[model samples]
Target: MSQSDAARWEARYQAGTAAYAAQPSAFVLDWLPRLPRGRALDVACGLGATAIALAEAGFDVTAVDIAPTALARARTEAERRGVTVDWQCADLSDLRLPPAQYDLIVNIHYVNRDLTAQFAEALRPGGHVLFEQHLRWPTPVDGPGSDHFRLRPGELRHLLWQLDILHYAEGPFDGRDGERLALARAVGLKHH
Candidate 1:
């Protein structure tokens, strides 16, 4: 991603017109009951919507993002919601997270292929991972240039095949911009 890209996202968050939806991602909500009660990490956590949701659900959440402005918004939201979360203002791609430190890792609407293995390795025993992102498709659907950031067919599942996949889905969805949602929703026990 370019500096401009990061700046653009920061600007969108600073605009603060509810850039983040009040609700958590559908995949996270769907898999909430099955999630182990422990520390969770929200990668590329823009504005802390998912992080706040996880905290509300009794998970010790660490939300990481590159933009301090965005983190500020997230902090404010957490304060307003009366829940606490560790908001780390760092680029996930470069940050070093402790191994096997989280029981759950959630990456929604963000795809960082290079970080997939690292994320999976960070899960503790019987940990779960909830992933949801746009898919690359030939026909335009969600918005212009979505294909650029979206995943290709079977990309997420294939990348996460090492984990015990509990759910997988890929298709066009009406919600969240005309984009296709691909989820590699998984529950796997780390081999000790």
Candidate 2:
């Protein structure tokens, strides 16, 4: 992530009274009942919502983000919720995830296409990855308009093709902010 991009996210998190909801992503919640309690990683864990949920579910959770401001808020929330999460501040664009370290990985509303391979490598064998992100829509909504930040149609499936897909969905959906968005959601299991 660029310094400017990080600054932008910091500003957003700092300005809003509640930049993001305290609840976990819908996709995460949907799969939570089926996931094993184990070491989990939440990438770009803005506000640490999903991370907090994972911790509460008895998973040892680590949440990473580029913005220090966001991570700070996440830490405060985790403390308030009475759950421990390892909050890490790092730019995923350059950070190398540890190999075979996580049993479950949750990535929501963040797009780092370059990290797909690393995400697979970071998961232990038979581990699962739950990912959801905004897609390039016909008309711009409240998302980064660039193709670089948005996934193309069917792009995510192709990206994680090596893994066994447990579930996949793509289409317009209502966002937390009540805005309409084209999104892609998926769950992939690493081969054992």
> How many angstroms is residue 51 displaced in model 2 relative to the true structure, after the best TM-score fit?
0.5
lDDT of 2 by residue, 67-180 (tens): 788788889988998999999999888988889999998888888877877888999998999999888888767666677778999998998887899999998888777978
Kindly list the per-residue Cα lDDT of model 1 for residues 44-112, writing each as its tens digit: 888788899899999999999877888887899899999999999776656676888999888887767
What does the lDDT come to for candidate 1?
0.76
Model 2 alpha-carbon drift over 4 Å, by segment: 139-142
TM match of model 1 to true structure: 0.87
TM-score of each: 0.87, 0.93
Distance from true position, residue 187, model 1, in Å?
5.9
What lDDT does candidate 2 reach at residue 6?
A: 86
